[model samples]
Target: MTVSNTRQQVKLSDAVQRIQPSGIRRFFDLASTMDNVISLGVGEPDFATPWNVREASIASLERGITSYTANAGLMELRSEISSYLKTNFGTSYSPENEVLVTVGASEGIDLALRATVNPGDEILIVEPCFVSYAPLVSLVGGVPIPVPTSIKNDFKVLSEEIEKRITNKTKGIMLSYPSNPTGAIMVKQELEEISKVIIEHDLLVISDEIYGELSYDSVHVSIPSIEGMWERTILISGFSKSYAMTGWRLGYVAGPEIYTKAMLKIHQYAMMCASTMAQYAAIEALKNGKEEMENMKVSYRQRRNYFVKALKDIGLNCHMPGGAFYAFPSITITGLTSEEFAEKLLLEEHVAVVPGNVFGSGGEGHIRCSYATSLPHLEEAIKRMDRFIKRTNG
Candidate 1:
């Protein structure tokens, strides 16, 4: 067959092209390829998936269980997730109808947005959030309105901030507790206040509680566990962080039957099903993984304390992160933009960290460093950072 005069110029979706690529991955791409690099950029656990969890996946694979599960997911896994959530946060979900397994919380975010949003609708995203929130909203033709939280307030999403953004076109809000980039977790009282705004505004919520278990100061409280938020909240969580199961790619979205049914429609079409072995592994994780997760959390707590102190000692303004594995410190003192600071530090000290501005507007002047690596690496990274800061500021 003769080729055309020119190869077909494929038309890309304007919606897809409209948003930018993830800022986190840019650092990862550079740092991952280099030798002698200590990366605090990726927000993933350093721990391996617990032996029991990995064994389950191995067992399933050994049995040749590579086929797709139900579109909604394995009923058994969903049931375990429901029971786990109820036990942890007192929120009840019907395994069959209310819980749908996803590829990860990433997929849950996409599925929830696609199901509920329409063009021109506004979704409230708390700033310094994960990079995907805004882009995902844009992909679904929903407008993302970021609500900024300050370091002074310890970065909790206040009800007042949320209320200020609630216009008639606002359809929902996206929240991540034990927030990415900042590691700020909302207390129950704060969530209660935000819950009131959610109720008064009659808004829906997409709560990403991927780091809920890693809260160092207190237990994580689910927004839906509060009165008046259940029916309207879509809860997204997963095993990637909690179980060190990033490779497993298993997560679940829980909501009211109506919203879940809608999400399932999207999940069925876009994903068809999550990984069968991963779903099976997640069931084992939910049943037996708490102790292992707690052990990992203890190590993280130690790292947080040591790293936060080290940052302060190095003359950086860093807030004590309450949860998750990241410490977001202001780099304004060094007189570098977040991207510049990150790139320079990577070049000078071979230490890679995420630039905060990539997360959203309010993230300017800050850098996010994940303490999820081993204590030794964190210590060395801090040493390198101290040297870099001194040399740069000097």
Candidate 2:
């Protein structure tokens, strides 16, 4: 008498359900299926991880030193990170208590938001940015507010723009300069302007400086180095881009004790610790990888210069990116939407690029092409893209 047949759909968490899959990944997956496809889509260094770093990892393995380190990460690695930051960016932190190594900078972003964001809290994200930031914020029950920066400002967020968006609900601001997608970077003066608004509003900042060492035109400014910013900024960086250590999955978060401890608590429960061997590699990278890192940087700068110039020569308008390996160029000349341009270019020219609109507002009518590959690949991609653009517009 009791059993009527019925099936109810299983519900996923609202955070998971609401967020869209990464737009960058969609193109990457498509590119993987095609042969001879020159992909300017993914933001990864083409260089192999430095040999010495690898050797360090190998030495550790040979020695059977594979046990887990402290939950906060190996103390030696943290100390190296502290020295690296201080020497390179003029930002200081206590290696003992302030730095927490995570799986990657991506995880640092997650821990930062989870530790700070409360239900209904707002986080201002400077866009066009890395694909992960807003989604991670939403996952933590924070409202991700896109503070869009246009090509006019070289994609740098303005103080007035930030001030206009600030409300009591905005708990923090997320910034990635030498930005992904756009490659826009803020100079000290520009950051100082934004810092005034941040300080006045009493907002915390999560500064993702993953590409800090890649700045081409000027020195990279660590936001925490700005007056009054150290107390409120969580500085996130890693060995991935700078040291060609992406697969190693190591990155760190450094800030005041209150915030660092909060993220550390989350890290303890979630990640436990970053890889022990990777930590040894990172120490090697910091201690002796400078020359190799600079060599890679010079190659990136060459690729960037060639690629950006090639885009402009092909009649696409692109601002010279100050840092990072991306060139966000306007595709409106082809009279196609960003997605249309990317799809058609992939289908027609065997070239893959991520459409700009996926990066957030103000990213429409443009496309993001990564110059992280070799110079020859970049040149070949540009040739294919040139053909596509001319064919489309003709």
TM-score of each: 0.98, 0.97
Cα RMSD of all models vs. native, in order, equals: 1.3, 1.6
- Please, what is the whole-model Cα lDDT of each candidate in the order they appear? 0.92, 0.92
lDDT (Cα, tens digit) per residue for candidate 2, span 248-325: 999999999999999999898887889999999999999999999999999999888888989999999999999988
* Total backbone collisions for each predicted model: 0, 0
Residue 67 lDDT, candidate 2, scale 0-100: 93
Candidate 2, residue 351: CA error in Å? Answer: 0.4
lDDT of 1 by residue, 1-394 (tens): 9877987888999998788888888888998788999989878899999999889989999999899899999999999989999999899999989999999999999999999999999999999999999999999899999999989888888888998889999999999998998999998888888898898888989999999989999888998998888999999999999899987788889999999999999889888999998888898988988899999999999999999999999999999999999999999999999999999999989999999899998999999999999889988998999999989999
Q: Ten-residue segment with the worst summed lDDT in candidate 2?
A: 1-10
**Model 1 CA lDDT for position 296:** 96
Which segments of candidate 2 are over 4 A away from where they belong? Answer: 1-9
Deviation of model 1 at 79, angstroms: 0.9
- The per-residue C-alpha lDDT of model 2 at residue 286 equals 94
